[model samples]
Target: MGRSFEDARRWMQEGTKAFLDAIGLLHGDDWDAPSGLPSWTRRHLVAHIAANADAVGNLVHWAATGEETPMYSSPEARAEGIEKGTRMSGGELLAWVRDSAEKLEAGMAGLTVDQWQTTVVTAQGRTVPATETPWMRDREIWVHLVDLATSTAFADLPEDFLEALRADVADKRGEVPEVFGTLADVTAYLAGRPYDNVALANGEPAPDLGPWL
Candidate 1:
């Protein structure tokens, strides 16, 4: 089995390539098009993905240094950071995202394999091991890639990451209401849905997902 760090790096790189390819398909005229992420345009989704690469980088830094680091010290600052990054022109935005992802990959690669198992306290107060950070990175890239509104679909996500995600969601199955149906149903049901709306899927959405759709 591939280690979590290896899985995360591979998936993150795959996602970045997909994101870039999707962005390349967009012309300036298409910037106004709707992304699958409701209320945000394609530009907004791309910018958010780029910003999150850095955010994941922050988490990695915390784990590597065993120091307390805050990407945005306050909720207001966090909002401002996203708003500012999202407002950049398409070329600038994509460049920033691409560059940041490269930097992040390099940073992640520098960590000792043993560091992958070291536990750390996140800015949110939850304790997690370094190994799980790749899962976090994978989720960000894979979900936002869909939110970017590419035709890639959830089924296109790597099997390793999807299976890991299926397992992760299963682990939290209790926290998610039973209305979403079976674990696989919940997995498929939550596709393209935002995290904040996850609770809603537990009921009306009937979470239906498979390779076909």
Candidate 2:
């Protein structure tokens, strides 16, 4: 069954906490280290995650007010925000991330059922109901936690969440492999990440998947 907004909100909170805790383990210099994402450092990933919270919050505000507040003024502005955030000192960036996440959570908590059902635009340009916002935030923090490369892995995710992720990725990619090791491995593979630990059915290498939003 699909998760309710309350369930999704709980997951989002837990996932964001886990991601924040993982990031807390990193040393100052680790911010400059490369993340699992290509061409993005830990700093870049952190900055993006922080900015994403504020952007999503904009959508929440729109849903509540029936106004057309976009997640970003433009794609360039969004990119520029991340770039600017990446240059902040480690302390500043961490504070920004924590503050933004807290604000978003509080905003979500205040939403009425009618408000949650209101339509809003995603940063990717797709229009979805506000109830979808929690799941969107859930995906961001959970996936980016692994991308942080700070000791957390997909295997560390809750089993139920892993199952949901598997289904989500499968929906996007289609054609599940016959010999996947774990739900986490399947999700990682479907998300277009390296799945060195995933065992193929025919002893062949994992196939390259197209980008997944």
Candidate 3:
């Protein structure tokens, strides 16, 4: 069976805590270091994650109140927020991220069964039920934790989550690689990260995959 709303919420909570713990370990210079993502420093990534919680929480509010609360006013506004967030000091950034995460958790907790089923628009312009919010946040926190490049690797993720992620990526990417390894390795490769451990069928390296959602 696929994951339920409760299951996704639990994983989202766990992933949030793990990501925050990893962020807490960053030293003075470490915050400015380049993360696994191109053109984004650790600060930029954390800020984006923090803002995402607030944005997704907006959808939850819409679900509960039937108000039309969009995640961001515009795509340009979203980009501006991230750029402005990068200027915050490390301590400020950490605090904002934690507080925003807490706000999102509280919002989700207040959702009733009916509210969970209400349709809301995602930042990507897709209209999905509020129940999907948890899984959306789950994917963001879990994947971005590794993208932080703070010693956490795909191997550290829960095996079940890795399996789900692999299937999801495969479905979205349309072409799955023939490489073989643990689900974590395949997931990492599919996520557009270099995985030295995966071996191709013809004894060559895994081919570069296109961007995933």
Candidate 4:
């Protein structure tokens, strides 16, 4: 059978739990440390995750109400939210994480099967079914968990997910080079993440990877 919203939602739930689990282990001072992403501290990564939940909730809202809602208020709103989040106290930041997730949960509260068929535009302008919402949030949660730099790596994610991610990145980044390794390693290289698990067949540094959304 084809995948349903419930299927995607399950992935979302699992990923969210994992994200929170990683954060639960953080030391009080770890928030100030640098993340896997360059120039972004753990504070920035956490804020971005929280802000992303809210943004995905906007898409859910659009689907449920059939209203024209874009993911962000404007192009700058995402950056603004992250910056604002970074400045928040630890407790406040955690609150936003919990509450913003509820925004998505509540928005998806009573979606009918038909509503799941509603068309929505992604932040990248791709028109997709409403069913894609949870998966969007799902991918963000899992991928950014690595950015937290708390011993979580792309190598730790599911093999199926890494393969799916490879296809996704390859589509966005035309003319991808072949890389061989565990699914996670190849996925990391394809997603433009820092990767050491892969190398050129001739032992040269591989070309830069495509920037994943």
Candidate 5:
């Protein structure tokens, strides 16, 4: 069975902590080092993670008030926020990350059982239950943790969490082709693996251009 909101909240908390642990691996010269992600340095990735947490927290604010609010005034403003956050010292970056994470944690903890099923529209314009927010939160941390290129890998992830991730990945079997050709082509597509011009094992060649992660 899929996880309940509490289950997902606990999972997200643990996952974010694990990600923070891995952040220590990037120090000094490593801050500007490239993670496997083509365009993002380690610092840039951390900034993005922090900004996303704040954005999600904004949604929590909206859910609390029953009023729809945009997390950022504009896409350009969001990009500017990320860029500004990226300029902070590593210590400062960690602090920013910790603060936003706490905001998210507190928000999730405040919800009652009934609130889990409450419907809400996402920043992406996707309509889903408020309970489902933790799943998305987990994805941001879990995927970016790997993007850091740490020795830790998803194999060490909780089996239940992996099962959750597997279902999520499977759900995106069709969308992966929006970038790559097909499911067979991008084994770890949803897991944030890049398509390298290889044939997929199950799906056929895609006709559309692959978008950036």
Candidate 6:
């Protein structure tokens, strides 16, 4: 079955705590070290996640008030926010993450069910109901947690969530090949993420995937 707003709410609430805990493990040199993605250090990853919260919150605000606020004022402003975040110290960055996430949580909590069904545009320009906002944040929290390559990995995600991710990736691609593997392996392959527990299915190397959605 597909997920609902309540499920997405649960995901955001639980996942945010775990994501914050995972990030809390990074220290001095660890923050400066490279993350799972090239050209992005751990600090950059932290900053991006923090900025994403506000961006997603913008959708919630639009839904509640029927305003036409885009996720960012402009593409350049988005990049600038992330760049500015990188300048913060570790303690400051952590606080920003906490504050921004809490602010989003409050916005989601204050919204009515009618407001949730109202349409809003995502950062990528797809128009979806406000209910999708929570799932969007859920994707960011879980995916980026693993991207940090700290105490989390693709295998750590629940099978159901992995299936959802796989479905999403396949949907985004229009069509995905039939690959028989564990949900984690299949999801990792489709999402262009790495998995420590990955196994080759029948000696065939997995097909190269594009950038992660």
Error of 4 at 21 (Å): 1.1
TM-score of 3: 0.94
lDDT of 5: 0.72
Total clashing pairs in model 6? 0
Global local distance difference test of model 1: 0.67
Residue 126 local lDDT, model 4: 90
Residue 22, model 4, lDDT: 83
* Candidate 5 accuracy as TM-score: 0.80
Candidate 5 backbone collisions, by pair: 179-210, 181-206, 184-200, 184-201, 184-202, 185-200
Candidate 1 per-residue lDDT, tens place, 97-209, comes to 88988878887888887766667655456688877766677777777777677676666777677767766654554344444333333455545253222334424543433
lDDT of 6: 0.85
Worst 10 residues of 1 by lDDT: 204-213
lDDT of 5 by residue, 1-213 (tens): 486666788889998999888886668877788876788888888998898888887777666667776666676877887799778999899888888998888987787666556667776778887777888888778767867876655556676776677566757654544434333233345455644454445556534333323
Model 2 TM-score is 0.92
lDDT of 2 at 194: 56
Report the Cα lDDT for residue 53, model 3: 93
> Which of the predicted structures, 2 or 6, would earn the higher lDDT when compared with the native?
6
Q: How does each model score on TM-score? A: 0.78, 0.92, 0.94, 0.91, 0.80, 0.94
Kindly report which residue stretches of model 4 are placed more than 4 angstroms away from their true locations once superposed.
1-7, 201-203
lDDT value, residue 99 of candidate 1:
93
> How do the residues 68-95 of candidate 4 rate in per-residue lDDT, one tens digit apiece?
8999989999999999988987777777
Question: Model 5 segments beyond 4 Å from truth?
Answer: 175-190, 194-213
Give the winner by TM-score: 2 or 6: 6
Better of 1 and 5 by TM-score: 5
- Model 2, 1-213: lDDT tens digits are 355667788889999899788777777799999999889899999999999999999998998888999999987977897898888988888888899999999998888888999999888778899998888888889988888887778888877777777777777566866556677787777877655566678777676676564
Compared with the true structure, the alpha-carbon lDDT of candidate 4 equals 0.82
